[model samples]
Target chain A: MPLSTVLTLHATTDTTLPNTMGHLAHAAFLALLDAAAPEVAEAVHGKGENKPFAVSPLTVHREPCPVGREGDTRGASRTAGRGRSVHGSRFTVHDRAVALAAGQECRLRISFLDDALFRPFSEAILTLGQPTIRLGKAELLIARVTCVGSDEEPEARYETYEQLVNRLPCTVDRAPCTAYREPCDADAHSVHGSRSTVHEQLSFRFTSPTAFRVRMAGGERVNWPLPDPVRCVRSWVRRWNEFSGFPFEEDELCAKVEGGVGLARHDLRTRMLEFPRGRELGFVGEVDWHLTKHALADEPFLRQLHTLARFAFYCGTGIKTAMGMGTTVCRAP
Target chain B: MPLSTVLTLHATTDTTLPNTMGHLAHAAFLALLDAAAPEVAEAVHGKGENKPFAVSPLTVHREPCPVGREGDTRGASRTAGRGRSVHGSRFTVHDRAVALAAGQECRLRISFLDDALFRPFSEAILTLGQPTIRLGKAELLIARVTCVGSDEEPEARYETYEQLVNRLPCTVDRAPCTAYREPCDADAHSVHGSRSTVHEQLSFRFTSPTAFRVRMAGGERVNWPLPDPVRCVRSWVRRWNEFSGFPFEEDELCAKVEGGVGLARHDLRTRMLEFPRGRELGFVGEVDWHLTKHALADEPFLRQLHTLARFAFYCGTGIKTAMGMGTTVCRAP
Candidate 1:
């Protein structure tokens, strides 16, 4: 059961919501999961084990922000206030009144690394229509479930990343999608080998502001201003190998990026991102980058590398993918 | 080995060429094949055998035609004369000098059912760049090869046509894509079995004018202006079974369409198509039809039927898929 599912929620009431809606959206996604498969949700977000899913930030579809900083800020707002009647979890937006209009829409997509959960999730989504949900001050009415699909199966081994990206849906912009790496503790045990023949180009468009989290020497978690490419790639590879039902170990292959052929970020700027839970101040920003000549040292791991890379496009990369962070669009070159 | 290849040819000449360019494209395509695999071409088109491929008519990208038909005709003219030097087969545009201008492009896509041939064909295409080739009076310099890929492997059984179509590339438009069958001879052997639970809706945009060739009572082949729904579905099913490397027959199944359900052609008109060999004055025309509830009698055949319908999209239906005919865009519902 090798599959990747994407669900498109078309908002009937407001689509012009602020980018910070990721928090509210993430709460609703969990509620939906709990409604569909409480056990599965418990297994994913419950108290001890690791999760097998990633949720993208709310991808808003609307006109560009108003001209000046003041004007743009006026068009989108966030406030802090508790819900009158809470179920499961309560999310509140403080004082911000600006939101998506009646006819506008936005998208909240989640990828299940575990294919076994697809059916329950799909069934739950199909039953959700016109659910009155509040993001902040605005109440949203979902018009329809526009699109839901599993990703195509991975292609033949030795296939280039440039050739694989075009086949995946929701990919935006052009090729050369890349993630930056500056070393991290999660991968403290990671070994960086020299390059191999997996020379391919990839492009990613950070549709929403994305952030990464890493632990400091004192065991305190902190957001990394710049994403660590090696850790990002490792997560995707590890998740895919475990849930794809065709498991492989990192120890079986040598994976590394050729030195000096570094990642190039383009046309991006940052925004201070806040969510409903108010646990931390996250960041969101637009990003476009290119990754070329990223190689896996072992010849036998070529197919596994390609499969994991392709999965990265759907499941996204970085921490809190399930909480609306790390949403990306990697186009095939 | 389940993959579909789409070749996007960026023309270094005018992009607004007429639909008739399919002739010149066919000539060049055969030449490319001859260069890559002469023996394969001979086996496909040579001797007396059914060709196992389909060639779509040249898909041109251009500014809309001029206001007056006469003005458009004046802008592009067709003059008849023999090729100064002929090779394999000669193709002439007949005094037509108004070809695609530089900086514009056209697409010539071909689908091969033989998975074994993908490698050699892919290699041959990658090596072609800036090849100065004459397509009658129009000389085209292929600026770049934009995209090339093989179709994804068929999804697991019990998959819906909707699911399968989305997994394959080259599908456009909305769902519930279908074809209308008004009744035809090829379907004479087609038993209109009573309906079962195999309900589905499909939409197909015949990018090229699609025609069907079926044998009459006397065993003579005739062209079908209107496609036979039963035969169309059957062909897709048969072809998919053969190429998917999974063999299954519907010996215990009966299939039928719901009453009053029919096909609707959108923005379509007919044209008398001619080829270089002058074997026959073939008719080709644009087709956009939606097929629904085209169900199979048995529940078990549902998966097989879905698989075949998806194959129809890549392999196409009817004859001469390899010579620029039967181009299609079948979208899932």
Candidate 2:
């Protein structure tokens, strides 16, 4: 089973911290596990590639303020005396650190990719030795923990690999027209009166900075920060195969996605993140995927695409997902 | 000189016609010239390779209506009783045709690439034989023709090649910070306190479907419908070189663009249009560009980039500008 958890916290004191807090969150999470389950903590800490869990950059539960003298004061607004929930969490990424005021509300989302880590992670969250956690120099008190989803955000979700596979709708209902056209896009199919039964159009919104580190022919490492449909789908499927233990035959599937999956629409922008060693650039935005008639007509592939799209909710997408680089979710336009 | 002219039209009768009218517009344009300037029309019709002029899809001066029974009646609302100009003219692309009622207002934008065609094109517009023009099956009266631009839309404009070259600002203004960081993006530059003297950023909004037909390694042609920075910049430069009559040395600049110019952001979508030959798929949307520290530092390359960016407004970004497929405008975000 896969499990996503959101830990809400209140700032204990006013302090400025790095805008990106994924690495710090990762460290604090380990510290939390050390207090409850040392063995699991040690295993997780020592785990190298394909770790069974991922963490998100800390997001304040308040609206973002413009950069100025009172920027820090504005960032640390408390949940008390406020009726409106923050619309969006767009922290100003600046050379200076972000300031969190005392009593400010915030959240840290964590997900376990493997079933083995689910119970342990849940237990660690319950039995945190300290009531407060440190992210950089700022200390925060654990205010709430949610494994449930809300209308706005799916704070938490749990699903088994088999459940994901078995729950797919087998057939897509065709529209009024039954004729088909071969050499055109989705829009053309509608125009040519090619009433498609495959009506699923998934738009993955990469909310966080998403990037891929690809090893070239000569083993040179190159960063691909843009949304390429093949790469995006491959990353999702690869994670599905790894955690779900699926012996998925994906060669043809990947090739089809590469050739047929056109980028239907996008509103993407490049962003930069700071790491211990250096900095990296990635893209953040929504990319709508357009499937070809063949891909849509193939029942198995269609189901597979849907499954992968839903799985992306928990699996993330590309490199550094554990440190909040590939936070992905499917959105309907 | 390049001239972009907008002709506002009023429908004489209510009629539902094909959603896309590029081919129809082309036919009607030639037909109009048959009465006004037959020689120039014959030359344009005979001219192969690069066309000196382009025609836009007819845009109704009214808000788009939903795909319901009343959609046609909604599309044809005349401007007679209203003081407001229509917003975005997103005519609903339906299986049927668009409905335009009596006295409905619309516009047709035409542009000329060659300086020699400017006067003849202007003369043709001035000496129209008929007061009414047909688009598809609908006949519309040429209510007004303007070469003067307003705030919302540059309805018409004229600029010479030398003027375009002379218009580029010599240098970019640096922000408050001054240290340099070569390894990060624009955000990172601001973060590392790299006060870049090169601060100019231009965004192009592809208001019409844009695409590239590339000849592959084996002479196979493929339609590239995504916004690839290299291809986008190269297309602009190629058109500039041809029409501006500049023997511009672009090898180094192109190499730098390929390696350094990054797609910063975009809100793009794929669209299909019917042509006389058949149909084609293209992308319509905005694509923001980011130049690397090295590219920004090179004054010549920077100026060249700015020149090409502005030139895109007139030259259009991709193939089929002559048929409104690459109708583009630069917008400030």
The DockQ value obtained for model 1 is 0.01
* Model 2 complex DockQ against the native: 0.12
Judge candidate 1 against the unseen true structure and give its global Cα lDDT, from 0 to 1: 0.43
* Local distance difference test scores for all models: 0.43, 0.64
lDDT of each residue in B1-333, candidate 1, tens digit only: 334444444444443444356667656766776667877666655623234555555443333332212122222222112211011122222112335445334445556666545555665666665454456655555543433332321111123234453342232222222223211112211111221122233445554545566443323344443343455665565665555556555332224321212333322322344555542222222222223332322333445444555566566766555555565544432
Question: For residues A278-316, could you state the per-residue lDDT of candidate 1 as single tens digits?
Answer: 433232322222232223223333445445555665666
Name the regions of candidate 1 deviating beyond 4 angstroms: A1-19, A47-50, A63-98, A127-137, A147-199, A251-255, A258-261, A264-269, A276-298, B1-333
> Model 2, A107: alpha-carbon shift in Å?
5.3
Error of 2 at B153 (Å): 8.1
Candidate 2 residue B79 C-alpha distance from true site, Å: 9.4
- Evaluated at residue B275, the lDDT of candidate 2 is 64
